[model samples]
Target: MMRRIGLLIFLGLLATLLIFPAVRAEEKKTDGQMPSLTGNIEGGFRLVDVDGSRNKFREHYNLDTGPRLLNLSLNGNYRSSRILDDFRLQANGVGGDPYQNYSLLVNKDRLYTFEASFKKSDYFYNTITYPVSRPDGNQTSFEEAHAFGTSRENTDFKLTIKPENLFKLTLGYSRMEKEGTTFLTALTTAVPPDVTLITTPVDEIDDFYFASAEFSLSIFDFYFEQDYRKSDNKLNFLSDPTANAAVELHESQTVKESLQTLRQPISRAKVHTLLFDKLDLSTNLVYSNSDFDVDINRPKDQFQAVRPPTTGEGSLNKKIWIWDMEASYSLLNSLTVHGIGQISELKQNGNITFTGSSRDTTEDGTVINKIFSHTVGAELEYVPLKDLSLNGGIKRQFRKLDFTRISQFNPPPPIENPVILQSGDTIYTLGFFWKPLTSLDFMGRVLIGEFNNPYTNISSTDTENIKFRVRYRPLRTLAFSATHAERNTENTTTFFKSNFKSDGISIGYQPVAKLDLNVGYTLQEGKSFSFFSSADAACFAFNPDAVNLCGGVNGAFVAEYQARSNILSADALYAITKKIKVGLDVRNIESSGTISFHFSDLGVFLGYLWPYNLETKLKYQWITYDEVVLNANDYVASVVTLSLGLNF
Candidate 1:
């Protein structure tokens, strides 16, 4: 019924447009007049090969063989416009372990304008492998072992309407889906009895609706917007996985089955204004109230003849709420600042349910859990010199987390968990743009991690980031540019968490405007922000002897860290004739040793007006791991992907 209602509303809007009087031609000033009807569509295809093999800290450092996968993709976009009229449509479809983006867009204008579209994106895992050795001497097997390929999906819809003057309204809907979370697993013994390692999968759904309206007032840039949004969610159970379950592979594992569903609502209002032509300021106030339940399942069982007698039952529902507000200001020719504050509350009022031969029982527990967060930041980029510029900013945040829970059994649990976090951050930047002859500029972000967060265990990390760049335009078509960067992350978790003190340098060259090349290399050793205690040890090792050695490796898995790695990417395009063209693209990475990932893509084009386009990509790679998983090289795997696309 809801779907039908949505369709009906969409149809009704379309009908209203048809019944309205014809839209007269728009009369806008222009240096010259030309018949509209102008647009171009470009479509291309890609193929990728991925190794699904589980990667080990050893292989990550040694460069071993792992899993191999194949993927294909096609994308395109087009737009047309006249004196005062325009329209656009764009779409792209793809499948791969990498995050995929696909969207559709349409724009039109009568007296004003209206636009609507839908987009979906998916982020997949990095790789996977198998036949890894357990911390124990025996080998372990994961019929479907995946180092990374869990996925996060984002689906959203939007609508925009502008009626010449007076007001504009926008309504949108978005859903965030997180599925199949990964966990490092390991076993203690070769023979499995009692229970095999099982780390539950984590999944969740967040559905929301947003609507906002803006009214134009006064000659100055003045506007106001009111927003309303609500969220509803559903949660389910994921498979129990094992391997790094006991190690420091991750910060903290989810206590629940790793999946959840919730329903939340939000509403907000903000007014923005510009006093002068060069200065702008805006303040926004937003409040969100959500009512939802978070539940964890407890399995019923009989432990060693002590039949706990607990069967077929679960706990009551728990809830959480969040509220936040933000504001910002920008000077067209000078500086900018932004700030926000938020509060969150969680209720623990839940009743437990139990079953018996003669009666069913319900129990209640203590309600608990609350958190508050605040942040403010600003940046000033001033061009005081004709060829030099300065940029800097400061940010601060404070957080407090409290939790509470009660049990009918003996010792009472804390009413709430206690955690406090705060930080004071700052950044400084410098740049130079000089027309030394014709075409040359230098830019850099030689910044630092000035945030000092004392509540928890943290370090004052430093940065040695520097970039040298230059652009030359000897002639219009004969343009070229080059750049190089030397960067360092000292015990920092800024651009990426788990990044250790490392140095990386990258160089890129571009010629003929259509061709580009880049290469980068990095080396590092870092600690994970999670389970890694000040003391280095495998937090999971059952014995004091192996704990430090085994659990410590998990901290080495950095979603953003490619240690001892090298990367190369390049793209080139050439017009063989007026109707035919060719292009080439390549991407390669060497995490360690000779074991690496590489992709070579080729493309061809022919025809005009209603043109024809086609492209193909070939990829290859082998991976390996170390003490963390398989015995250095206990596992191996590979695959290849091919794709095709067309444009009109």
Candidate 2:
């Protein structure tokens, strides 16, 4: 109702500016200081316990059981005030939280400044099951009856005028909302086409308006901005022909869909300069235009056995352009030079119309799309000594695409070509940094790329990337670090290949005088190779005849995938006196080859300082998930939190 009365009058004007600076803390004194209030206010209570799949514990920690405002802050400052000078208010996870946030800021110094923010989030998903091989060679297991959940909200407001330098102005507004439930799939004219799952309801909304301007003299600095956006989407589908009764006989439907979108006046410009005193420059521009509309309704459908009702309509137009430029030079006193450029363009047009009740399901369609892109780069840097540094760079990129499709269905349609694509890439880079001693340090980077698409065969003609880092400190509390990364890609006309690798190590320690420590480890690997089709490898061998396994060159083959991950982390802190403190955190993860998993996390915390500026905290957490090949999507969770605070 009126958005909960405008969110309770914006939380009662932020609780009257957070209690009017603590009730005028001893009044009197405007320019002689007296308006100062620091921040802190916290409250919390949370407990959660789950032992196995509450849909994988809400897909991993969507905590519940709570009374919380876990954190809040208020800050104020009024020195020589006519109205206000500084203010801030903050909040987090209010109550009954799946996620929540609130923020406010006000300032009146060089005229005005104001800001507001709000956020909320929640989402969940579940649906997994495998094994299905039948065509008389029986094997059964299924559960792809989809599931999705959602809740999203965001709001923002901003106002700024004259602050931090010559000529400035700003205005803004934003809103977003999403609500949901999902699952949709339909087809049931029987005879090898009986897949039916429908349960969909979703609503979405978005709105935004923005404005900006800034200017500065003496050599240059300028900016401009304007924006507008709107979107609305909805969907509802209801079908339950006895809900997939052992897979078949499903054709009772009711569907409705609508979509609307508009984007206009989205423009931006920017410029920056420093000319002569070692030269530096920047430039940017952006443009946008968009339009969209869609509608679909299927009053009731069961077709052929007569139940008919269908309709559809669609429209779209889009445009986008972007530009960028950058420059830098200091060619001496340790040399430096850099340059960059970018450009982008896109255009699209669309149309679709359908009305069915036979006539072979009336249809009409048209669509066109185009794209262009460009990039250029240059870089050079060298620092003869004094901790050493060297770098080199080169870049070139180009892209072009065109697509078109037109139809008016009749017994003639299989392939009607109108597609074009052009691609190019050339990238080379090298980087380095070294500190030859005094506790050592080193860094490295290398990249190589070359690509040319002769109209794609899954693109990627050659690519490689490598990185390395190292750091060490003998003692003063000991420290060490290491990292390595690699990437590779190749696709000599569909002999596709891919690779990725990573390694990391870290350690930090403070050993005494109040203890502190940290440890880390990470490893990741990935591999891929592709070329399928034997009716997609017989539907990944779940084969229900897979449409009688299509023809061609021994039905094509070669398909491989691999993934690996290992991570371990640890942290600790201790102070136990002068107001006490303690903390610990641990995490572990292991995953191997094509979807295998094990994960664990443990956390502990305790803090106290009660004596006037009161503060207290206690936390505990444990989480685990093991799904070595879907053990019914394993899960285990436990969490507890307690907090209290006051510091002003």
Candidate 3:
């Protein structure tokens, strides 16, 4: 509550300064002529995959796009009747994207104001990894990478107007698209590894719209904005994973397919106002919706028999909605308070059209799901002395979820076939913040929750956090600081679970405007083998059996990661020109436990800061994983990225 009130006063004073015409705009005339326009462009790439013999970076959720890009502006005049007008172009125009740009901003001023921009990034080359075992019945030894390529394009435009400077309105639109493909043969499962898994191709796209209003005057000021966005992602999930659909291999095998669709929609709005000298208030609202669609064609008792297949198509669709609202009020002179609250609803309403060759398998798949939640909180801030202040807050959070599954295949075939699952939990929290010295900062928050009903462990855990940092400059060209942060999550999936924790500190120094250097270390701790999956645990229920995998010193899958780790990295930037700059960044990660993994990243890029200016950039990224093991599967690759943009 206090935080909101404080910020309210801050905005009140800011609006007073703006509408009073007392503030000076930063503009300078150059030799009585228009200023010349200038800017640059950059792009780069990188590949990350599991470390091993078959090291390709291909898998679900492609991230291997070698090239990333940026679009922007520098030295822009927000109040010009005649805005920027410019041109420049570059590259082979690969993927229909020129490393540079060509543009013209002209026309007259009107009640309606408009702005537009475009961005395109060069190709992406990457891969991901999965575990593998040799025919020799060996437990470990092979690794592979799935090579993928990428392409992307985006654009946006907006228009606004104020017939009266005291009342303004605006509207805008945007679009984005991305696509990628694999570069290998379909030997996806060949021993010694076949390249077949790389045969799938996928692409995604999105469109958006926005509208808002803002007004200002000497005695009063008001602000408001509303936006609605919708996006749909598509993919052809595998209907079957078996090598031969006509022949069954395992008696009780798990069916694998990627038949799912995700759709998202979001609407948001905000309103704020300032009065006389001491009062201010604001209210904000947001609504979000997610639509889920799943389709699966399978033979009943899909795992049991090769003959007499119970095959058909089934789908489950779900929708979720969320609402959030926040408001605050403040008195300008001294004391202040604020509060915020939110509620969420996940409701599913859909149908599953079913099709099959036989009547026994012909059934419409329909189901419903719902989740409800609420969160409320408030805070207070008091200044006891000119340079001293105190802050505190209390919050309550609650969540409830219910899932009901209805089907005609129930063995008993009852009158009303429905499966219901109910879950919920409540939490209490406390927080504090103190800044006793100009160079010192402190903050802390603690939360505890009890659950009679909970859907996931992450949703009902008790947590704690504490952090501190200090910055001091002993000389004009030299400065340094240290910081430590840690977090703990309890009441995990089970009582056997141990909290996760990490602590770290670092020192940094900068001797010039173009150079920066810093180094730091962190230690991480986690739970052990008892945290393994129930099925994997049952494998070691016996002492001798357990020793083979979890043994006395180390357990199994749950204990595979190290408990303590350290990281060392340094980032730096150098200005090539007032409008252009270059950067270099590197990091090294090391672990203390036997299962710990070590890795590193090296990045280099150039940045351009010209407004509505086409900028092109090149980037190179390299990564090395599991540095401790002398395993040949340990591999490296080079990625190159090219990008073009205008105020992106």
Q: Which candidate is the best by TM-score?
A: 3
Higher-lDDT candidate among 1 and 2? 2
Ranked by lDDT from best down, the candidates are 2, 3, 1
| Candidate 3 C-alpha error for residue 82, in Å | 4.2
Whole-model Cα lDDT per candidate?
0.41, 0.74, 0.48
Q: What number of backbone clashes does candidate 3 have, counting pairs of residues 3 or more apart or in separate chains?
A: 56
Cα lDDT of model 3 by residue, 283-384, tens digit: 555565556555554433322223233333443444444555554555444456767777777777566554442444445545666777777777666666
lDDT of 2 at 459: 55
Return the TM-score for each candidate structure.
0.60, 0.32, 0.61
10 residues in a row with least lDDT, candidate 3: 243-252
Candidate 2 clashing pairs, residues 3+ apart or interchain: none
Judging by TM-score, tell me the better candidate of 1 and 2.
1
lDDT score at residue 189, model 3, on the 0-100 scale: 29
Best by lDDT: 2
